[model samples]
Every structure is written in C-alpha cells, then in structure tokens.
Target: MTEDRPSTVGVLLAGGLARRMGGGDKPMKTIGGRTILERVIAQLAPQCDGLILNANGDPARFAVFGLPVVADTVEGFAGPLAGVLTALDWAAEHRPDVEWVLSAATDCPFLPRDLVERLQRARIAEDAQLAVAASGDQTHPVIGLWNVALRSDLRHALVIEDMRKIDRWTARYKLAKVTWPDKPIDPFFNANTVEDVAKAEQLAALDGA
Candidate 1:
C-alpha cells in the first residue's frame, strides 16, 4: 500500500451467474496455464492491503485461494452492484480501518498493476467519492474503487430501491474516471466466452503473464 493513499481491501467480484459461458464460474477457466482468478489475484494482491472474494454458492470451491468468500447480502443475484455492496459490508465488519474497497471482476486476467494506485490518486485529485477505469471510450463500472463509508446507502439502494445497474448508483455521487490505453492489449480486457478465452491465451503471451 502506498503511504499517501487510504487503506484499501480488494474485492474480487465473482458472484455473477456466468450464463453466457455455459453457466459456471468464469474465473476458474484457465488461460496461460493459470486460472483467470489466479491471474487477477497476482495483479491485485500487491496493490491492496488485504483481499476478499464476493461469490455466491458454496464458498469451499474457492478455498484453495484462501480468501474469505462472502455471499451477496442481497438475496438474489443482484449483479455486480451486489458484489460491491458485499465488499463494503464485509470491509466495514472485518476491516474497519479500511476506507476503500477496490472491486474488480475475477474474469479480467490482465488488470493493470497500477489499478488501485491510479484510482486512489484520481479520486483524491478530483475530490470524488468513487473512481472507475476506462479504456477505448468504454467505462468498466465493475472495476473501480468504492468508499466504504457508503455501505449503508449501497445497502438501501440494493435492498429497497432494487437498483441493479452500477452506473445508476454511481451517478448519485461525484465519480472520478481514469483512462488507460488500449493499444497492444487493453489492460482491462476480459474473457467472457470460449472465443474470448482463445484470444486471451494469445494476449496473455503479450502481457507476459
């Protein structure tokens, strides 16, 4: 962790029902001889003070990773926003000292190493309550830094408002957007399907993973 940045806990969002990839844990798929989850962990572990996983169903499946797996506090699969809320609630309960929760999708194998640092810097510079990453004119709402202070509001949005869209909730506050280059290989590139996995295999070599 950087000395100037607030303490952060990384939350790997794996609670989605991967219906597109034949319905299973997408992060468990292997690429470059390693699971996508493994690659995501390698990229984020050094950038966070601690890490937890937001996943539904049996937590024992991810026991090998040795992370505290938290199910969505919201009953049904409420999308990535639910995962974000889970992280916020978990951080508040287990790591009160942590002020931020960095959430990233587990299927994104090549997340930039500077992810947390850059998001923190941008949020502070803009005096924003949240920060998100962008590449090639596209914003990845799921990959961002969340304020742990907003846990209560997020829970209300999830449980009462029935809010499912991440962007809609983020729009309620000041948000910092950080952009990354897409050339060579987009650092935020994700494998969402079998075809994408094949492409990721090739991109992994370029990423030197």
Candidate 2:
C-alpha cells in the first residue's frame, strides 16, 4: 500500500459460504472466460498500491493470486466486518504507510474502475471515516473504504460491542456515500449464483455500456 494515491490497499473479501452457488469457491468460478477472482484482480489492481485476499480455509488454493491471505481474526464467520478486520490487521501491521483500504466483493466483477479515487475523494470531502458505494436505494457497506486506525475499535466492537451488522459499524464512524448510476449495466454488479455467473459473462462481453 502507498500514500502516493489515497494511501489505500485493495482488499478482495472472498470469505463467503456461497450457499447460492451450491458450496464452492465462488471467486474461483468462471465469468467471461476468466475466473471471477482474476477478473476482479485485473480490474482493481491498478487503483491501489497493493491488494490482498481475505478468506478462510486453505490459503494455498488462492496462492496463484500471489497476495498475502488473511483469515477472520475471530473464530466464526462474523461477516464482512470480520473480513475488514482481517484486512485492517494486515494493513496496520504490514503496510503502515497505508491509512485506508478500498474493499470490494470478489463476486462483483463490474466494480467501477474509479472506485478508490471516488471514495477517497468522498471521505475527504465529507470529513468521514468511511465511504461506501450505493446504487439505486441500496447501500453497499462491503464496498467501502475503511480507516486502518479503526482496527482496535473494530476488534472491540466485534467482541465486546456485539456488533455484527455492517450498518452498525459504519454508524460508529462518519460515513460518506458514492453513487453509481443505473447504467446499461451496473458497475457494482455481483454474481451470487450460476445464473448470475451467466449474466455477468454476458455483461462482460458488451463492447460499451
């Protein structure tokens, strides 16, 4: 991670049960002739100084990505917040110069290329501790920028504060929102099932929005 841009590291949260996908590494599945994880990496790698994958189980399976892998700091699957915690812990300890992390779901191949820049600018403009992307009327808490300084607070919240909801975590800190237009195809589109994978493939092949 480097402060040269927004001092942000890209964290791809791949830790999921993937019940919708009939129990498989959803990120490893195919989309547009490319693995979902590869597509996301190709899209997000340029926007940040470095990137890491957050997932449990054997890290060897994802070694091809060549980024350090971090698992949940807590015992159980505590959801996106846990992934954020893992990423924060990694950033705080390994990449001290990076103050923020830009997170996106491994399933969201269409994430806007300008995500990091837009969210960083939003956080600064709003004097907020976090910035999340929103589309339609839905708020994407997972797709947000987190302040690495919140690791201690986040850990405490997960263990002591009994906070599990992503909305609850964001509420504790100032939050800024970035909106994505409902274009021909949503930039934040995510694939959660086989059908979704097919749709994502069709969308990926489009020549223009």
> Considering every candidate listed, which one attains the maximal lDDT?
1
lDDT of 2 at 26: 92
TM-score against native, each model: 0.97, 0.94
The sequence of per-residue lDDT tens digits that candidate 1 reaches over residues 1-209 is: 56557789999999988887988999999999999999999999999999999999999999999999999988888899999998998988999989999999998988998999999999999999999999989999999999999999999998999999999999999999999999889989888888888999999887688
- Local accuracy of candidate 2 as per-residue lDDT tens digits, 1-209: 32224778999999989999999799998876779899889889998889999999999999988988999888788888899999999998999988898888999878888888888888888889889999877788899999998889999999897788998878878899999885787877889999998888888788332
Q: Hey, what RMSD does candidate 2 come out at? A: 1.8
Reference-based lDDT, each prediction: 0.93, 0.87
Q: Whose TM-score is greatest here?
A: 1
What's the TM for model 2? 0.94
Candidate 1: residue 206 lDDT (0-100): 75
**Model 2 residue 70 lDDT score:** 90
Residue ranges of candidate 1 with Cα displaced over 4 Å: 1-3
The local lDDT score (0 to 100) that residue 175 gets in candidate 2 is: 95
